[model samples]
Target: MNTKQSRIRRSRKTRAKIAAVKAIRLSINRTNSHIYAQIISADGGTVMTSVSSNDKEMRAQLPNGGNVGAATVVGKRLAEKAKGLGIEKVAFEAAREGGLVF
Candidate 1:
């Protein structure tokens, strides 16, 4: 399989395992210009919270929304939102399956 297809296959498997345990997940997605983060329900049926560099508030504070600084802001914003929702724990999914750690 190609790189993109392989990554998808790996992520599906990892997500299946996480779903089996019904654990909240912290998912992140990075594009060429922006980074986005979200807290997803165990069943993957809903997104509990989300943050991204493209947000209006974030965009105003960050001169360049695609840099690491912007990503850091998004991450912190997501964490604060999760805490407010009473979500104290989450499994982090890296770029894709087998990417660094969970």
Candidate 2:
């Protein structure tokens, strides 16, 4: 199988396992120009909080959204939001091919 398909398959399996656990999901999506993160409810029906490098505040601070520095900022913001919502645990979900480094 090709790389893209393999990555998708891996991600699907990971998500399935996470669903079985019924834990809050910390999902990360990355693009060439931005990085996005969201914390989903335990039932996976609602997004409790989200942060992105493309956000207005982030964009104002960083000229480029697709960089390690931007990723750090996004991660910090996501953590702060999650803490405010009292989310202490989560199952991370990210594509295998280009997952978040931290």
Candidate 3:
């Protein structure tokens, strides 16, 4: 009915679609002051890897974590972590309302 409700409905449908695929997911969340990325297991019970602009290391490197540059940094960090864990591929799940269901 309202915008927030519509966004929630869209996100719910997206989550259902993701679950049906049974594949690892790379989810991204961007807020006003931070960016976060996560790798989730197929069943969504496990978080394989995660990185955020709020991390201590990232915080030091990025004085301002609200911009696109900060988001890119978070994304790259997440990718590196995933690679180290041998996660070569995943389904991209961009949150309609800014977070994954899990």
Candidate 4:
């Protein structure tokens, strides 16, 4: 009905599909002030790893957390963490104005 509700509905559908396949997911959340990313377990019960522009290391290198540059850094960091954990594949889940994108 409302925008938020619609978004949630879409996300639920996407997540359901991902869960059905039992695939690890790389989820991303963006705010006006920061970008956050995480690797989630197949069951979606655990967060394997996470990275954000607000992290101490990122904050030190980036004067502003709300920008494409900061988002890139966060993405790179998340990728590194995933690789270190032996994660080679993931379903990408990112929020977009239209809906959640995979």
TM-score versus the correct structure, for each prediction: 0.85, 0.88, 0.86, 0.86
Off by over 4 Å in 1: 94-102
**Predicted structure with the largest lDDT when compared to the true one:** 2
For residues 1-102, could you state the per-residue lDDT of candidate 1 as single tens digits? Answer: 899999999999988888889998888889878888888998888999999888899988988877878887787787778778888778865443222224
Q: In each prediction, how many residue pairs overlap at the backbone (N, C-alpha, C within less than 3 A)?
A: 0, 0, 0, 0
State the lDDT of candidate 3 residue by residue for 44-75, as single tens digits.
Answer: 99999999999999999998998988987787
User: How much is 6 displaced in model 3, in angstroms?
Assistant: 1.0
- TM-score leaderboard ranking: 2, 4, 3, 1
Clash tally for model 1: 0
- Per-residue lDDT over 1-102 for candidate 4, one digit per residue giving the tens place of the 0 to 100 score: 999999999999998899999999878889999998888999989999999998888999998898988887787777777778888778865542212124
Cα displacement (angstroms), candidate 1, residue 59, comes to: 0.4
* Predictions: Cα RMSD each: 4.5, 4.5, 5.2, 4.8
* Residue 61 alpha-carbon offset, candidate 3, angstroms: 0.5
lDDT of 2 at 31: 96
**RMSD of model 3 against the true structure:** 5.2
Clash pairs, model 1 backbone = none
Question: Which 10-residue span in candidate 2 carries the lowest summed lDDT?
Answer: 93-102
